[model samples]
Structure formats: structure tokens, C-alpha cells
Target: MTVRVRLFAGAAEAIGQDEVTLADVTTLGDLVARLVADFGSGVAPVLDRCSFLVDGVRAADAETRVTGTVDVLPPFAGG
Candidate 1:
């Protein structure tokens, strides 16, 4: 199945877009692997510090099952 991913912060800049469509991703981890492969090292650091949400709720694990729309949120820095 296909899923919609929304990228944020540095992750968005690395991928050059705010959203993307991923196909045949069985788990959240799989989707992340694909994204790393697609964007290469440019996105690696951010991916390492990222968190995920399915729909609107935080995903607890990379193995979490996902569908429809998800958000990939990279760590944000502030005081």
C-alpha cells in the first residue's frame, strides 16, 4: 500500500519538499529506510534524531504499523 509522509524542519529541507508518497512500506522502519536510501547522507543525521506520528498520534516504535498519512518530525532546537 501507499502512504503519505509529511516532512518537517531540516528533514523537509533535505528532501526538498514537505510531503512525499511512499509505496509498499510495511512498517514505519521500512519507510524510513527507503527515505534514507532516496535522499542519501544528506538526510542521515536528521533521520537519526527523528520521531514519527501516524495520523496525529506519536508512534512508539519503528516497527509500528502505519497507513494513510504520517509525519516525520526531526528534532527541533530552542532555548
Candidate 2:
């Protein structure tokens, strides 16, 4: 399967881009592995602090199956 990823905040900075298209990423865990493998160490920490929305639905766990668009959102601060 192919998944389109949208990165925000630190995730985008770490990966050096806000959007990416990945193949064979069947689950959230698989997507993380692929990002770490493709982008190296910089992305891991950012990913760790992030939450994911798969097709606008919150992903409950790394094992959550992913398709369509996956949004990577780092912790946001506002007042």
C-alpha cells in the first residue's frame, strides 16, 4: 500500500519536508520505521513526541493500519 504523509512542526523540520509519499507502509509502525530508515536519526525523536491522524482519525497505536493521508503532529503550544 501507499501512504501520503503530512508532517508538522518538529516532524517536518526533522524530515526536511512537510509532505512525503511512502510505499509498502501497511501500519503506523511500518511508517515510522521507514521514516527512520530513510531520513536517519533526526526524525526518531520528533516522531516519538508526535501524534498521528490517519485519514483524519486519531491512530490509537503504532500497530494501527494506515492508508490515504497520515498527519504527523508534534506537541503544540498555545495560550
Candidate 3:
């Protein structure tokens, strides 16, 4: 199966793409590891700071099963 990841803010800039498709990634941890492997270590920090939305719902933890679309959103700043 394939999972689609949508990056936002720093996460998008770090990977140089707003969206990517990954294979063989069944959980959030797997997806994060794959991204770091594919995109290089530079993306790790961004991923660390990101909050994930799995198919439009906030992921509870790294073990969260992932499918469909995953949205990677970095912390936002506003006042």
C-alpha cells in the first residue's frame, strides 16, 4: 500500500516538496523513518517539530497506523 504525505510550512520547505507518496510505510514511525532516509537527515528536525494529521485526524502517537493522506504541519506562530 501507498501513503500520501502533505507537507506544510517548514516541513514542506525542508523536503522541497509539498507532497510525496511513500510505499511500505504502515505506521507514523515508519513513515517518519522513510522520509528521513529518502530526504536526508536535514528533514529530521522539521519532522520532529511537526504534528501529523492522518487522513484529516490528529495522530495520537508514532505507532498510529497511517494510510491515505497524512498532513505534516509545523507549529504556527500568531498573535
Candidate 4:
């Protein structure tokens, strides 16, 4: 299944886009690896502090299965 990922905050800047698609079911960590590879190590530090949401609800684990639309949310610095 293809999953859509929406990037937010520093992630969006690192990725240079707000959205992307993955071709199969992947863990959040796997997806992050891909993103870091594609974008650059500049995203790595931010990614370490990032969180994920699968279709809106927070994903508590990096091993969490992501099969559908997901959001890659980097740490936000503002109120």
C-alpha cells in the first residue's frame, strides 16, 4: 500500500516539500532513514527530536507500523 507523509516544521524545510509518498508499509524509523537519505544529514538532528502521527493520532513508537497517511512532525519552537 502506498502511504502519504506530510512534513511539518523543520522537516518540511529539510525535505523541501510538505508531502511525499512511500510505496509500502514501513516503520516510522525506516521512513526517517529514507527521508534523511533523500534530503540530507541536515535533517537528522531534527528527526531525532521529531514525532509522528498516523492519520492524526500520535504514534508512540518508532517501530509503529505506518500503512496509510502519516504526518512527520518535527519539533516546534514556538507557542
Candidate 5:
């Protein structure tokens, strides 16, 4: 399964992209682990300050399954 992660604000700056695609993701935790592994410490802090949105809905669980685009929204990035 391909999961799309949309990064905003500092998260996007850390990754240097607005979006990223991950493969074979079963849960949101899986994606986070993969990201930590892939980006090392660079992305950790950014991720910590952000929240996850799964298909436009707020994600409350790290164990939430990835069904569509996962938006990584930083605090007040909408502004």
C-alpha cells in the first residue's frame, strides 16, 4: 500500500518537500518509524510538533491505519 504524507511548515522544511510517498504502510506508526529511520534526527523534532490528519480527519492514534493521504500539519501552518 502506498501512503501519501503531506508535510507543512517546519516539517516540510525539514524534509524539503511538501509531500512524500511511503510504501507498504499498515499503520500510522509504521510510517512514523520509517520516516525516523529515513530522515534520521532531522525530521524527529518537526514531527513531534505536528499532528497527523488521515484523509482530512484528525488522527488520534498512531496505530491508525493508513487508508489515504496523511497530512502532517504543523501548529498554525494554515495561517
Candidate 6:
């Protein structure tokens, strides 16, 4: 299924966009891996410190499935 990935603050700046539509991802982990492969260093470092909200609930686990929007938030972001 397709998932919407939203980036905040430094993460968004690094990727040069706030949101991306990704396909063939089932878990947050899968999304991370894809981001790293697609964006490389530009996004990898940001991912290291990023926290996530999947469908509006905090995604504390990497295995959280991406059935809807996944917001990638960094600390002190989006002021």
C-alpha cells in the first residue's frame, strides 16, 4: 500500500520537501530504509533523531505499520 510521509524542521529541509508519497511499505522501518536509500546522508542523520506519528498516534515502535500518514518530527521543530 501507499503511505504518506511528512517531514518536519530539519528533516523537511534536508529532503527539500515536507511530504512524500511512498509505495510498497508496510512498516515505519521499511519507510526509514527507503528514505535512507533514496535520500542518503541528506535524510539519514535526520532519521536518527526523528520521532514519528502514524495516523496521529505516537509511533514508538519501528514496526508500526504505515497505513496512513506518518509524520516525522524532530525535537523543537515547527515552531
lDDT of 2: 0.96
TM-score of 5: 0.89
Question: Which of candidates 4 and 6 is the stronger one according to lDDT?
Answer: 6
lDDT of 4 by residue, 1-79 (tens): 6889998877888788989987755888788887778788888888788888987889988798787888888766778
Q: Could you tell me the lDDT of residue 16 within candidate 1?
A: 89
**Model 4 TM-score on a 0 to 1 scale:** 0.85
Off by over 4 Å in 6: 77-79
Per-residue CA lDDT of model 3 for 1-79, tens digit only, reads 7999999989999999999999999999999999999999999998999999999999999999999999999999998
lDDT, residue 13, model 6 = 88
- Note the clash tally of each candidate: 0, 0, 0, 0, 0, 0
Structural similarity to truth (TM-score) of each candidate: 0.90, 0.97, 0.97, 0.85, 0.89, 0.90
> What overall lDDT goes with each candidate model?
0.89, 0.96, 0.96, 0.83, 0.87, 0.89
Model 3: lDDT of residue 33:
97
lDDT per residue as tens, model 5, 1-79: 9998989888889888898999998888898888888878778888887899999998888889887799998888335
Model 2: residues with Cα > 4 Å off, grouped in runs: none
Tens digits of per-residue lDDT for model 6, 1-79 = 9999999988898888899999999999999999988888668888888889999999978898888899999878355
Model 5, residue 67: distance off in Å is 1.5
Error of 3 at 16 (Å): 0.6
Compose the digit string of candidate 1's lDDT tens values, residues 1-79.
8999999988899888999999999788898889989878678778778889998889889899989998999877898
> lDDT tens string, model 2, 1-79?
9999999988999999999999999999999999999999778988999999999999999999999999999999988
CA-only RMSD, every prediction: 1.3, 0.6, 0.6, 1.5, 1.9, 2.0
Q: What is the RMSD of candidate 3?
A: 0.6
CA deviation > 4 Å runs, candidate 5: 77-79
Count of clashes in candidate 4? 0
